[model samples]
Target: MVDLTALLADLAAESAQLDALVVALPPDAWRRPTPAPGWTIAHQIAHLAWTDHVARLAATDPAAFYGSVIAAPDPARLVDDGAAEFLAPSARLLARWRSGRTALAEALAAVPPGEKLPWYGTRMSATSMATARIMETWAHGEDVAEALGVTRTPTARLRHVAHLGFRTLGHGFAAHGRAAPTAPVRVTLTAPDGSTWAFGPADAADQVAGPALDFCLLVTQRRHRADLALVATGPTADEWLDVAQAFAGPPGAGRKPGAGRRAGARA
Candidate 1:
């Protein structure tokens, strides 16, 4: 079973760390373009804040949450607001983002474990809510780090993201008008802290293994699986890499070798 408390705690901690990172950036730097095409640092943080607010609303009241979804404006509006606020000398935008995250964490803390909450058409337990938050923060954080030309150490929280990615692979393939592979694929992730995470049956016909950071980057589509030392032992393993996805809504355009090259590597 998922540990709701531990997951929530990790979400809060990671959110706080991300908040600090944004707060420390110079005003000009916040408007600088991020690795996510057309998104600035401010835009990324704003999306985080907005999503947290949406999640909080979803958790507390299901019907009201779905009601608001219909009226929600394009996320670009939030990004515009973020860019404007970031240009100001004060840190109001950062503070607002932090406040939203705090409220989100508090709401999760008060919820009873295993309680089902409405999210879009389905209901999710408090544990799933926390897990989703961690996955988003880590994914977006990678965008910020990439824009800034920095590297971030992987945390245990990444295991949750990896698990979700593995679970979603079949859906990813189907969305692209392709059939799921006939053979099962194994995944082994070695995290920075020396902890390991694995998915799939031990006797699966194919395998992929590497550092957790590399796995997360590949599955998130931030980096290509081939760019890292990810080992794939069979045809199924290679096929799975072509369609890995971490998000639920839709399969993003999968990364190819050109887009997958590591920063500064020759084209």
Candidate 2:
């Protein structure tokens, strides 16, 4: 299993960094286009802030959380409210994001080490929740960073993201109306700090290997794996490449070249 404490600390630090990045933006930049379709920088930050709030609620009341709140009313209306609520004012958005993040971190720290909290469809431990949050933040941050023409270094915490990607491969393939690939693929990621992470069978004939940042980019569909220095050794590895996903909900349609280059480059 992954280290829960370290994962939470990394997530909290990343959230703080993102908070700083958002606040550093000029007022006009908040309305600037982001990589996410139809979302501005304001929209992206709003989603993050709202997700943090949702996490807190899930931590507090796992059993009733999804039913009473997440599944209530029109989903689009909820999303719109979440986006509009945080985007009310640039300064207030930044303040609320920072303050809410602090509270969320505190709540995470208060949970018992092995207790499982209710999430989208399964019960997740505090550690898993922290890791999931980090993955989501990093993925969305990629959108913002691309819009700003900035590059972020991949961290050891990305192992969590990669693991999530591994777990969701079947879902991605199923969404495309295709059966899951038959063969296993090995993934090896080298962190910016020089730590190495691996997933899947140790002796798998097929493989994907690269820096953790690139792996995250590919899995999140923010960048094509072919554009990076990733190595795919077998048919299964190649197939996995076409269907990798790191986020929840429906599978993303993935990106095509030249769609939005001025926004940012893939890490």
Candidate 3:
């Protein structure tokens, strides 16, 4: 069984890490653009806060959650709309994000075991929901770090994001309107501490291997695959790398080859 408590702890840590990055930013700094197309640092935090708000509703009030979804002006712009709705002064936005996330964590922890919570066109267990939050916090944290010219040290918390990326292989294919391959693809990654983190069948012929950080960046679409050092052994694995996405909804346009931190922290 998934350890919901441990996952929640990791979620908290990931959020705290990201919070540390932006907690003291000047008001003007909040307007800095991130790698995500039109998102500023403020937009990034607002997105997280808005997601936490709806996610809390999903846990505490299912009907209200669905109602909010139905009331969305445009489904295609849901993510951006939420971000814009939650935009505020730096202090208020920060406090809103912190409180919203805390409420979400509490709501999730109170959920009954085996119960699933409604999500964006899907449902997930409390553990899975927590994991998803960690992935987003870390991915967006990367954008925040890059914006501040800060290179964060990868932590074991990335294991959650990496695991999510590996588990979302089929989702990635389906999001692109392609059939997911039945063949298993073994992923062997070198963790931040130089330890091996392997997933999938041990004897699988198709394989992807690389630094855990790079894999997380690729799956999150924070960096172009061309800029990553991952090696795919089979055609399936190769194609999977090209279309991988850790987030739900549609496939992202993703960053260009040189759009990431290739040039410096400023990149």
Query: Who wins the TM-score comparison?
Result: 3
Please give, for residues 65-97, the per-residue lDDT of candidate 3 as tens digits.
999999999998999999999999999999999
TM-score of 1: 0.85
Clashes of 1: 0
Candidate number with the higher lDDT (2 or 3): 3
lDDT of 3 at 233: 94
Give me the runs in candidate 3 sitting further than 4 Å from their true place.
262-267
lDDT of 2 at 78: 61
Give the per-residue lDDT digits (tens) of candidate 2, residues 62-179: 6567765656576535655666666757888878887777788888888987888876546777877887788888888878877788877766667778888777777668766788
In model 3, the worst 10-residue window by lDDT is 258-267
Best by lDDT: 3
For model 1, the stretches where C-alpha displacement exceeds 4 angstroms are 73-90, 120-122, 180-182, 254-267
Which stretches of model 2 miss by more than 4 angstroms?
68-71, 76-81, 258-267
Model 3 scores a TM of 0.96
TM-score of each: 0.85, 0.86, 0.96
TM-score of 2: 0.86
